[model samples]
Target: MSEAIRIRVTSQHLAESSNPAQQKYAFAYHISIENCGREAVQLLNRYWLITDADGKKTEVRGAGVVGKQPVIAPDECYEYSSGAILDTPVGTMQGYYEMQSADGNTFQAPIPVFSLVVPNLIN
Candidate 1:
């Protein structure tokens, strides 16, 4: 039921939290997960594939987000903010969320690939 879910992402560079000289780049991403279906769904787990400008890739897998597995109601939305650290000034994140419907059916909601870039770094 891919059409039953919608995922949106926005990101910002945390300059204060990053040290370019030290090869540390920090970025914060805000996610909005909307349940467009008629049934409620619970987020079970998250899988992320982060790739930096240098072609370095890192994968992250965890239970829930922000320490909580939230149940989103029909036509409702759940939002959260989280950050990632990279070695380069630019990166991209894409993944999916494991979701369980009220009827015990499990499905994956895709997270669109979004950019993480430091301001003025990319032309």
Candidate 2:
């Protein structure tokens, strides 16, 4: 697999009932993994490093996101969508994914830091 991890994030506003009335916030994300190499790759695990505007940090370590440890063949891809809760109006998240190739080689792809900011909150 390639050394670079391509990630695209799209955040949307949840229903007003989904969040506290006093806090203006929303949740959204789309994670897609593509195997661009010649060999097959199996997702081993995932780790998320979430940071809030209050300087609090949380580390989430677990096996396979959304359950199954998918084995992606060359040119194939898998995608997952999830939501996040943020205490403040703005925050960020970053993490990594562990994967093993068919040849018994393992590697990690770093997840780029994405922002979670409420629209019009800055103005």
Candidate 3:
């Protein structure tokens, strides 16, 4: 079945906030979630699998995003920005959002794997 929600991401490296010497790479990501189904849905939780360049993995689980559980109506969208710190300059993030529809049906809205790379790192 097609997903009722669509997810998109845009990421940017934070140079000033990152300490390369300490292997601390910081990136800010903006996520937009659009509801395409006929029913409205409330985002209940999020689960993320983050992988660093060395193949190290970290799993993050939490309630809501940016401190709010947003309710999105059909054809509407919700957007939020968050940050992640990694030991490598390049990494990937993929995960899913747990959602509850108006009728009390729960489902997973998958967020596609997205890259986080420092500029000029892959020339």
Candidate 4:
């Protein structure tokens, strides 16, 4: 399938915000969404599937991201930073964005699976 939007993710372990003893692992992720098509699109909603090391899964569905429904023009990019807390030291997240094009067509833009791991957790 042709892609109209591309997503890139970068993750960081937040040591200062994590409590290993309590099984709380905090991670911050920066996401950049680029419109690769010829039309401008507005991100309407998001759906995420997060899985922890123990196979625990959590689903997050929300409207917009960081409180804004960003409209990205063709060849333009939108960036945001978000955080997630996991019970394990490592996990993975993947999802899709619901977008509406300027011409009124709606589509789903897939967000590639990315890892969320604490530094030095694995060799």
Task: Count clashing residue pairs in model 4.
Answer: 0
- Model 2: lDDT equals 0.77
TM-score, structure 2 vs. true: 0.86
Q: List the residue pairs that clash in candidate 1.
A: none
Model 2, 4-61: lDDT tens digits are: 3355566665655246566545677788887777778888898888887898798988
Show the colliding residue pairs in model 2: none
lDDT by residue (tens digit), candidate 3, 1-123: 128788999999999999999999999999999998998999999999999999999999999999999999999999999999999999999999999999888888999999999999967
TM-scores for all predictions: 0.97, 0.86, 0.97, 0.97
Runs in model 1 with CA error above 4 Å?
none
Residue 61's lDDT within candidate 3 is 99
TM-score of 3: 0.97
Whole-model Cα lDDT per candidate?
A: 0.94, 0.77, 0.94, 0.94
- State candidate 4's TM-score: 0.97
